[model samples]
Target: MWFFIQAALYDNNITFSTLGPPKFIDRQEVPNVPLNAPKPVIGLDASTKVATDAFDDLEPEMIYLPLSAYSHYRLRGRSQNYPLLYEYFDINPYSGKLETSRRVSDLSMLEIVTGSMRPLHTGDFVGLSLKLVYFFFGILLSMMIFSGMMIWTKRTYKSTQTLLSRSTKAPSKTTKPEPSV
Candidate 1:
């Protein structure tokens, strides 16, 4: 869950919510619509435009041609565009979208892992799996912290007991003979 949130924030170029509004890259621009226009209806194609108003609220990063299935590429910053950063798997055996990209062949394993210049999609099974993995690890980390505290407390109790015993014994041993006078 934390990974997903960080990815969301990083992709959107938003450091903090209070800093500013979120931004995204529109895959394509609506015809006759100005690029700088506010809240323009956006879509991949002309017919699909009428059906989906989902992208209407998002701030567009860039207007480009030949919009893909996953269009919204979140912005990294003012200087560079955020790379595509997701991988999808087909649940159905009969049909699946084949992974094909002009850029994918050029990407190294580290690049893919870091999402340096990769594109992310919403329906990515791998990305979703990672979220679940991180959640489990987070729980495990909390358990480890609790166990460590318990060990420290036990050690502290033992040390305190030893000190109390030594102090009491010293008081008894320091007593002087009353017949000295």
Candidate 2:
């Protein structure tokens, strides 16, 4: 799988297929890795016995512990196979893994797939999906029904108009006035 391949070959300097290979650079030496790393702001609140706690301030975000501080982190006896990001946070990365993957590390294996990654609420996705489905089929059905109605109504209107026009027109075949004498 791509995840395993990424994990395995990422640690070593190796070339994969034309699909492009993972570029392996020693992690310890890479200053840019930490510099370029995106840290999403996380916040929390602490309550005192006297007052209800409110979120005080945004704290420094950390996804992965720096190599120097890895000892201070409580990674404990977790295996190397466990993602480094999860290890540092003391959070269970595997919480959603099984539902998200058919087997281990199957990123592409999912029950529902959208074309691109976008942040969306669960209800938003469900509602949007339903709306899209309804829009597609509903418009098609409406168009067909409208077309049929137009055809039927147009023919009836045309026929009635033709008859009305003919009847209303002065008779072209008016009989010649009979001789008075």
Candidate 3:
């Protein structure tokens, strides 16, 4: 999977099949990993409540300590998006330990992915191109539909005008026809 491949090689700085056969980077110091467990929602629940709460204010969102990723909750900054902007904490149901977190050190993997999923100017170049292409096609589709509707409407209007003209004609002069006989 790309996720594992990214985590194993890219995150660890092991590149292959490119400029180098196998590239490795040594850390000046060892890294430390955090221990975060999932938590539940601390406040009210609703459609707007859930979505708005995440992006409304600068809150140190609670760690859902006893929930699964499906219902995982992370407090976010104002207008912050989870998959791209902020780090997340999700507790594994079986392990009861923090399982998934966003990229904290490097920007390659996250930028590579979210760039395509969402086309921000600051993402991977190819991904950004893909998103732009998708948007262009979407606009094209909308224009196609609107033009088709306009054509249909014009045809209908012309047909209605012809029918009305046929129904509302001036009466022929009866006396003028008798002169011919």
Best by TM-score: 1
lDDT of each: 0.41, 0.35, 0.45
Of the candidates shown, which would achieve the greatest lDDT relative to the real structure?
3
Instruction: Tell me the number of clashing residue pairs for each predicted model.
Output: 10, 0, 6
- The candidate with the higher lDDT, 1 or 3, is 3
Q: Locate the minimum summed-lDDT window of 10 residues in model 3.
A: 17-26
Order the candidate numbers by TM-score, best to worst: 1, 3, 2
Candidate 1 per-residue lDDT, tens place, 51-131, comes to 122223222233233233333322211111322432211111111111121232344565455453222323223346766
Q: RMSD in angstroms, candidate 2?
A: 19.0
Candidate 1 global lDDT: 0.41
In terms of lDDT, model 3 sits at 0.45
RMSD after Cα superposition, model 3: 15.5
Ranking by lDDT: 3, 1, 2
Query: Per-residue alpha-carbon lDDT of model 3 for 103-177, expressed as tens digits?
Result: 323346555363334334434223467667767878999999999999999999999999989778856656644
Cα error, residue 97 of model 3, in Å, equals 14
